[model samples]
Target: MEVVNRYLETQASMCFSILYDRYAGKIFGKCLVLLKDEALAQDATQEIFTKIFLNLSGFGEKAKFSTWVYSITYNFCIDFLRRRKKMQSLFDDDTEVERLKDVADDVADEELMEMETAHLRAVLDRLPADDRTVLLMKYQDDMSIKDIASMLDKTESAIKMKLKRAKEKAYRFKQEMFTEAVL
Candidate 1:
């Protein structure tokens, strides 16, 4: 996309705006799945876009453009989490906890999946960040293991192992939650 490259080379902020309009929601969706907080994910999205704009000069046609952007978004979020020194990068604070609980309280809420997803996110948050990230890159983003491994600088087999372990943890969390409810 010459236009995209021009947008970068010229520092045409509006051109970048068009690019943002094209993919902000998808990027935000990925961020939400990774961070599990609306606000934090929103912030991460902004940061990712900023990084994209600044680093556009470095990007090449070696891979699909979408894949390149996805790689940037993934790395940006992971860096944010690491820089913050958070035990879990899922939520920035307890407000998200309150918000999710409130949504579950609403009787007419149509998207029960949100609650389930959030619950699953909480379980995911308990996992080591590396394991959680690999699972998200695989399941949430539909990334190939090779792509995911490259993004994370890990081997494909290692990504597979991490994915397997993450799945088991998620399953165990589900079983424990279900058992507690029954008890």
Candidate 2:
């Protein structure tokens, strides 16, 4: 673990290779959740690892090393979503989402949960970065409400309201999608 940090500090290519070996699938699973495109997720996975390598010194081990790395991956995918301003895919099935939480990327569950997730990803992408970020940090990254509020430099109540509003928008988008689908 420390060696991964050292490799980034030294910018050694071989060390980076080792780091990639250690975390590539983990990063890819994260990307798939955020970006939802196998190809772009693959690219985003690589790009995130590259960014981590390039900026590892900035990582001061303030959080669990994994959390810090995940924060970077999450932020990168959100940025990619914002730039694209589109939602072309639903996430992997719910089992996959849970499996993604594990180290092995195993998908033991196979049921798709459309209601559980809605068509809001694109709409969420359309939100201001601040609003979008709060939701991703809360829902996608599973950050505590207090932690998210602190990270956003806001109060806990404010973060809750933002999450509520974000949920409303996602629900609205789901309704819209349903209407379109029915038609």
Candidate 3:
């Protein structure tokens, strides 16, 4: 924040460079995960930072600086995917209401977190983009439900439901992969 405040106060390029050095790699990794293509991730990372630079003056203190940056990153990736796929909606919505009714079992966060790294990655890869995205936002990014809700422009309960379904799907994918491997 000192960096942001300094940049805001002096409009100095050096302060911005410090910010870029700190966040660029993390942002790029996130882009690569969401975009699923090295070239497109590279392009998206650059474009996202450009948007950040241009919008620096508009940074409000409502959210943490990291949260604000990630919001921009995630939103940019989602919008890119939407345009590329020509889809009106990027997330699974109420159409799955019937599927969501069953709650006989829930996947514990520790179960997902404790998986071998490669297995975890494989399971995540098998999930639909929307499911993987919500899981990343919740577990990997440590984003709060309120924060995610705001980011996705959904109600808090809606984000919770989405997150629950994502975890369930991830767990199912993990089970199927390992079961098939053993067979």
Output the number of the lDDT-best candidate.
3
The digit string of per-residue lDDT tens for model 2 on 36-134 reads 569998888878877887677787876777777877776677667757865323121122221112223221111112444444555554544444566
lDDT of each: 0.70, 0.62, 0.83
What clash count goes with each model? 0, 0, 0
Please give, for residues 22-102, the per-residue lDDT of candidate 3 as tens digits.
Answer: 999989988877877799889998999999988988999888999999999999988888888834566647464434344
Indicate the worst ten consecutive residues by lDDT in candidate 1: 93-102
Question: Rank by TM-score, descending?
Answer: 3, 1, 2
User: What does candidate 3 score on TM?
Assistant: 0.89
> Whole-model lDDT for model 1 versus the true structure?
0.70
lDDT of 1 at 127: 64
- Go through the candidates in order and give the C-alpha RMSD of each one to the true structure: 9.3, 11.0, 2.3
Please estimate how well model 2 matches the true structure, expressed as its whole-model Cα lDDT.
0.62
Worst 10 residues of 2 by lDDT: 90-99
TM-score of each: 0.70, 0.54, 0.89
Query: Residues 1-183, candidate 1, lDDT per residue (tens digit)?
Result: 776887967878788778889879989987876677899999988889888877888888898778888888878778777787764543222232211221223222122123377576667767656667776676666789888878887788877756655566565565566547788
Clashes of 3: 0
Query: Model 3, which residues run further than 4 Å from truth?
Result: 92-103
Give the Cα-based TM-score of candidate 1 against the true structure.
0.70
